[model samples]
Target: MDWQTTKKDFKRYLEFERNLSGNSVHAYLNDVRKLEVYCEDLNLEIEKLTAQHIQHFLLWINEFALSPFTQARLLSGLKTFFNFLQIEYDLTANPCELIETPRLTRKMPSVLNIEEIDSLINAIDLSKPEGMRNKAIIEVLYGCGLRVSELINLKISNLFLDVEFIKVEGKGNKERLIPVGQQAIKYLKIYMDDIRVHQSIKSGKEDFVFLNRRGSPLSRVMVFIIVKDLAQKIGLQKEISPHTFRHSFASHLVEGGADLRAVQDMLGHESITTTEIYTHIDKDYLQSVITQFHPRS
Candidate 1:
């Protein structure tokens, strides 16, 4: 099959069969496109590819000095694509079967201390109409440990505020109930009642919990800008993003003796290993505590 046709089928598989998010589907497709370009340069066909060609592609990408993490991700995407070809097209053998992924060092995420988090939130100018909305956004982000994608797509209909829980659609369109802190619930109500109710919401956007002043849903970049502005206002030295609040949320929970599995559930992580990163954060916290409090020289 032509590379373009194969890509279309792969996109459908990623979107429908695998139920990946739009961003994830886009990233995987981009990875395949890179390989497609490499193949085209050599006049190679899809079915004609073998492990040596795939290795050559990896070596070729290496010439561009892509980061190991990115290299690993590209290899993973190709592996997944080849696996799909094996299943759907009855390919005799997957070309990427013997490929080894590049090793990556997992960088620990930056986390905000309770004081820093408070400082960031307290820096908001509440006189503006959007102030309360921004407050609610930060609260929900930290309080629920939501990914920015989940935060932006959060729906008002999913908010069971009376019960102090909100349902969010996580990766792969999986839904989960996350308990909302009273602080988050309070700010959410204020934003909804005071700020959101007065907006001229665009048609088809009414159910969205967060919105721009124009009444459309907040874009992901807008959320990042919000977090960055807050950090600057507080003169915080650490560079961070909306995801940092999520890391802080989990780190704080683990430091307070919350179970790892529960943290995984709240964060909507598919695997416990993904959540275990916080345990490393927890260990760092312990080290600091001992360094500060221990009497030994």
Candidate 2:
């Protein structure tokens, strides 16, 4: 198959069959582009690619000083491509079978302390029209541990506020019901009753929970900007994003002794191991828990 045509088919497979997010699809395509460039430089077509060519391409990317994590990530995309070609297109042989991914170290995610969380939340200007909505946005971000995309796409119909839970549509279009904290529910109600009810919502966006001044749904970038502005208002020095609140939510829950499997379900993680990355407990807290609870102590 030709390079462009094969790549197009691969993208369709990722979108339709795999149900990967747009960003994920783009990343895989970017990896394929790198391989394409390498082959073009050697006057070799996609059909002519061999295991040696794939190895040399890996070497070329390694020379750029990319970290092991990035290399492994890129190799994952390549593996997906070759697998698709083999299974779907009935390609003869897959060169990626023998290729090995680099070992990756599990790095801890940055989380905000309770004091910092309150400070950031309190920093929001409550007098503005979008004030209540932004406050609710932060609350929901932390409360439900939602991704930015999930937050933006949140629907009013999915909210089960009466039952104290909200149905979250997460990655891969998976839906899970997450318990909402009282504070999140409170601000969300205020935003809905006071601001959202008064605004003339855009036709298609009427279902979205959070909306902008124009009554259209908030974008992912707007959510990032909201988080950044709040952090700056509180003079928080640590680098953080919307996802930081999600990490903080998971970390706080784990620290409070929430069940691992429960947290995994709330976060909509495909694996419990994915949820484990958010856990970061301090030594003092552990010692205190042991000292208070142990009979010998």
Q: Which ten residues in a row have the lowest lDDT in candidate 1?
A: 88-97
1-297 in candidate 2: lDDT tens per residue? 778889999999999999988888999999999888888888997766778888899999889999999899888898889889988778888887788888887777788989999999889898888888889999999999999999999999999999999998888788899999899999999999988999998888889999888989888899999999998888899999999999889888988888999999999999998987755444445777899999999
TM-score of each: 0.96, 0.91
| Tens digit of per-residue lDDT, candidate 1, span 111-204 | 9999999999999989998899999999999999999999999999999999999999999999999999999999999999988999999999
Indicate the TM-score of model 1: 0.96
Every model's Cα RMSD, please? 1.3, 3.1
Per-model CA lDDT versus the true structure:
0.94, 0.89
Count the clashes in each prediction. Answer: 0, 0
Q: Name the top TM-score candidate.
A: 1
In model 2, which range of ten residues has the least summed lDDT?
Answer: 276-285
Give model 1's clash tally.
0
Query: Candidate 2: how many backbone clashes?
Result: 0
